[model samples]
Target chain A: MKKIIFGIAFLIFFSFLIVSAINMRTFGEPAYSEMDDYFIENAQSETGANNVVTSVVFDYRGFDTLGEATVLFTAVVGVIALFRGVKK
Target chain B: MKEMSRIVKTVTNFVYGFIIIFGFYIIAHGHLTPGGGFQGGAVVGSAFALLLVSYGSLNSQKFLKKDILSLFEGFGLILFIVLGFSGLGITFFYNFLANSGGWFGNAAVIGVNPGNMNTGGVIPLMNIAVGLEVLSAFGVIVLTMASAAEFTKKKEKS
Candidate 1:
């Protein structure tokens, strides 16, 4: 009975995934790409970085990177706290 | 968490330095290349993991100081925050240094030519700060886990 239920659930999940994949938009052709176009065209002159992705990440979208750094720091703090008892 | 065999240790010694240097290269060249701080930091972190696995937790402690790593992590985060605030004269996270004719201020070629190393402004600095934080964080986590595992194993044996 459990195997039958599991198989049904698996099939349902995979069907959803397959449907989405089949209906996915074409690659490198986002519907809303005005911002992307701007960045690609002007990032070099504005940020002086050769890599547009890097400029977007570290310059234009710096807040997101800050949040990521905070999350990593918090995770490290948690790990250290968990293992505090083992330290001499 | 006993040390690996001599062959594994030898190989790690031979390779870890290069791995670390390559990671630094990625981080430093992040503005010009495909990688950035996080990707390069992960690469360096893997080298620390390699060191811990081959040398054992206890033996690795001499070099992988947890306190120093923690300090560096804190320092990196603080530096990033400070840099963010530095641009408040215009706005938060402003590119104040770009094209300023100062350090890292040279204008890049309009289109695709060879990338200049001295082109990125605050981006490179931020990359270094983030890279340092990530590498240290990885080292601390790996060291802590290895030691914890060793402690648990000893308790089990007893």
Candidate 2:
């Protein structure tokens, strides 16, 4: 019974993924790209980073990086706390 | 937990240095090249994991100090926040130093030419900061997990 349920769920999920993949647009050509065009054109001069991805990650969307760092910090804290009593 | 076999130790010893160096290169060249802080830091952290796995927790404890990792983790995060706050004269995380003809402040090279290191303003700094944070965080996590696994193994044995 469990196997049957899992098989049904897996088929449903797989079909959903396959449908999304088929409906997706062509490779290297996204449907909405105005932001991409702006970044490609202006990122270098605006942020002085030749790497637009870095500029986007660190400068244009810096808050996201901060949040990422915070998340990492929290994870470390949690891991260490969990293992503290196990220290030899 | 005991160390791995000699072959694993030998391979780890040979490859870890190069892995660390490559990670640093990725972080330092983040603004000019493809990878950034997170990618480079992950590479270095995997090197740490490799060392821990080969050497085990007891021997690895000497080199992989938890206090130092915590210190660096906190320091890197604080440095990032400070860097952002320093630019508050304009706004948070503002690129105030770009094209200003100072340290890491030069006009970016146009077109498809070789990029310079002394450009990109706070991007490189942020990259380094984030790289440091990520490396230490992953190190701490790996170390903690290894220690926990040792505990579980002992519990099972007893």
Candidate 3:
């Protein structure tokens, strides 16, 4: 019974992944028609940075960057706390 | 795998040098290329990890210090926040003083490209801060793993 349930779950997961991969290939790539060009053009002016992607990540979406940094900080703290005092 | 011979070690060292240099190149050129802080920082961290593996951690300790790693981690976070706040009066992360036209043509006052490299806005500084933070974090992780492996090995020996 356990084996049957596990097999069914694995099958479903694999099937979903395969379907998504097939769809992605068929679609080739999704166009970001709304803000892609705008982002590329004015990113430099707005962010005062050369790289458009960096401008987008660090400046235009600074709140998100802060969140990302906080996540990294939390992970580091967690790791340090977990492995605090195991002498070699 | 069998033990690495002298010739193997020499070849690996050469490859490692190339990898480290290439990673720095990517990090430096991040502002112009597709790669940026996170990817380039990870590359550099991996380079250090390679060194730890090639030469034993005991030997690598001469170069990698735990205190320095902690310092870098703390400093990186502080620097990032400072840079962020420097733009507070304008917009957050705003590039203030990017177009001041240079104070007497010095690199410190005005940027080389105004909007490109040599711009002392938050971008380059942030890149470096993130790089340090990530490299230190990766070092800590690798150190933990190495210590765990050593402990397990000692247990098996006993």
Best by DockQ: 1
Query: Residues B74-144, candidate 2, lDDT per residue (tens digit)?
Result: 99999999988888998899988899999799999777878999999999999999999999998989888
Candidate 3 Cα misplacement greater than 4 A, ranges: A1-32, B1-5, B102-116
Give the CAPRI rating of model 2: medium
- In model 2, the Cα lDDT at residue B158 comes to 97
TM-score of each: 0.91, 0.88, 0.75
Note the DockQ of each predicted structure.
Answer: 0.81, 0.74, 0.28
In the range B1-158, model 1's lDDT, one tens digit per residue, is: 88999999999999999999999999999999999889999999999999999998889999889889989999999999998999999999998999888989999999988799898889999999999999999998998888899889988999
Q: Model 1 over residues A47-77: C-alpha lDDT tens digits?
A: 9999999999999999999999999999999
lDDT, candidate 3, B71-149, per-residue tens: 8887877788887888789777766545454521112322234334654346666777777777777777787667667
Q: Per-residue error at B40 for model 2, in Å?
A: 0.5
Pairs that collide in candidate 2 are: none
lDDT of candidate 3 at residue A16, scale 0 to 100: 100
* True lDDT of residue B79, candidate 3: 85
